[model samples]
Target: MWKFYLFLLPIFGVNISGLYAKNDQKIILATYTYDTKDRIENLLPFADLLKSRFEGKFEIETKSFPSVDELILAMLKKEVDLVFISTAGFLSYIDQADEFEIAGTLMVDQESESTYRSIIAASKLSGINSWEDVKSKSKGLKISLVNENSTSGYLLPYLHFQQRGLTPFKDNFGLVEFTGNHKKSLDSILTGEFDLAAFGENDLQNLSGNEDLIHILWVSPAIPLGPVMVRKDMDKSISEVVEQNLLNLHQSYPAILESIKAGWIEAQNASHFEKLTKDFYIDFLK
Candidate 1:
């Protein structure tokens, strides 16, 4: 769904035919608002910050996409100027180097690690206690995942299962469902709708009150956090402005940063991605 953000100050009228011929005149800030709570908690503030930074120079609007492909397609069509996407989604566009560029990577906390893990959690009622039990006994159990494009929810778990000689959705599980987001997947597991679910470890932190109900079967090795990506054809000056605004966001907007887990830091480009792209898969796929 598309949500129009209203600015506190009046937006100056700029002729669309001149400086913004390609991007439909407005700079679209496309991000994945998978969790409903985040739409209010994290996204609203983040969008407000962008609007404040760009002001009248660029008419900025925020929109959410259902999947990674749609998000990338929006960039290809010049409908979206920037995207906040996952690491797995970013990797899918790495070969098309001329089209997309990394704006910056999201850092979750003061640690600024730029990394996270995939957590496999199961209900105690499911009788699955350990990773070995999951390997031997997941058949006929209802399973849930965020989505195919999710790094912790699906991608990392897929790679983990493959390494153990298991085919995730095809392995005759009672139900293999995509709940669209980690919160939903974890909730389903907690409510008895799913025997097991895979999601980001951060999502698990929210379920701290229900410790007696679920068991974390496994946690995958650390993986790089996703980066904010932008189209290459955007105005160079606009790109620089957006980049500088984000790098210094934490100091200016600590509350906003804390709302979204943490603030962002400069990304190390392709070399930083080597661990996720080359090492992570090579160790498993091979």
Candidate 2:
């Protein structure tokens, strides 16, 4: 698995302060999307930012993956050079030991604060108040989840249930459904079409005035927002250039930061992902 961050990461490599190397190759930059035009639009300017700094040497690209595995397949096929990917999507590709390294992490601000989080919520009508309630009543309640690729929407929530020996998949739940995205998942639960839903904390926050319609059952630990990823063998000069630009974006290029409501931070202090990664491989992925 990729270390995914660092002063230097234990498993991933970083060279922000190291000596540089120049490669003639034009660095490829891309972001993963779930067939959303909005996500494609958000990704469009990223290459422009790099191009401005690199004197027009970036190949702007975007890949739309219906699922996380497709993105991993693209990486395995060497079809991408750098990509913006969720923590779950990145770490789930366990065979990617040396092919890539985390170049940076996204932050909602200049500091380490990242608000990427998961929530397990119940319809007010569901009679489910907590994990214990869900466990005891798992057999008959319908549950909605965003697809498997989602970190805040699926992965962490899935692992949370798994840890307590309550596999929603095998518990004879009334219906286990993938709502495709967070908003739909919220919508399903809000209307009482589904008794439970798992999705991002921000999704509920974005849907104001609906608090009375839903009961909050659980919230996950802050998931590190997605990171910037690059090939491990990328030219040192290019890597340093990208890292420096990432570190400076909040200042030198505020619009880019604002576009995504997040800024790039140094690839440092990601030991938090270690346990998450380990548990995923040892427990969830199995």
Candidate 3:
């Protein structure tokens, strides 16, 4: 009887160990978009497909943050395994580039590669027509940026001004203010609270109904869009699995493909942002 009891103990321990291993292999994805609610609902089909394909190898979970800074904080603390961040957010840690690896990019359009421009817009009544026009009208003008941390909303425009030898506050670009979000920036411009605003071309298009109230005075050269990255210390095999899953998402889940208006593409190393280091567009707290 003693020998039989010892044998049963080993068999039960094996089952418990298997369950723990399953739980540990799960992956956590975090993003900073309000659209996360809709995205999650749309992603269910893809999630189910990945689970079926990966079997007991992995599981996927997601979370959302109101701002990219909050998402970055979570990543730094090892609370999230993967994240999707704007170019500016990624650039913030340019010096620590090796801390994460690019796994994939979201193709916003059907084209194999898509790029977006940065627009500097202002109320038509403000008479701002060009970058030069902005410099001339600087006396007591009010300006708004989507957020200090936004790539297109703040960094691009800020760097553009610097390159042209124009100092924002010193040259009197006006009272610099953060509108908190892109939509609000447009609203401020339309209502005359702000004489000028900066935002992504994509965001501008999304708010095109207000075209009569605002006008784009300038547009930046196309820049690389958003990227999905994983911690550098993550298990290589696990990262590879996530990469493959994303790349195959469109094929596996047609509904998700239509909803996001994008397909996944193979990702290259994200070291490309290194070139923009001199621009000082991104500021990583740590």
> Deviation in angstroms for 223 in model 2?
1.2
Per-candidate TM-score against the hidden true structure: 0.71, 0.77, 0.73
The residue ranges of model 1 lying beyond 4 angstroms of the native Cα positions read 1-25, 35-55, 95-98, 108-116, 191-193, 253-286
Pairs that collide, model 1? none
List all candidate RMSDs to the true structure: 7.7, 7.7, 9.3
* Candidate 3 structure quality by residue, lDDT tens digits, 1-286: 2243234334433232222334466667666653223245444555555455445446667666777787777877777777766677777654544566677655444323433666778898787777778777786678888776687788888887677676655467658888776677778888878888887666666775778888777777656655677776665555555565566555654454454333211111111111123233323211
lDDT of 1 at 10: 23
lDDT of each: 0.64, 0.65, 0.61
| Span of 10 residues, lowest total lDDT, candidate 2 | 266-275
Please provide, for model 2 over 175-224, each residue's C-alpha lDDT reduced to its tens digit, 9 standing for 90 to 100: 89998888899999889999999988667778888899999988876666
TM-score, cand. 2: 0.77
lDDT of 1 by residue, 1-84 (tens): 012222212233323333344445567778654545223334557666666655554567777776677776676676777777
In the predicted model 3, the residue pairs found to clash are none
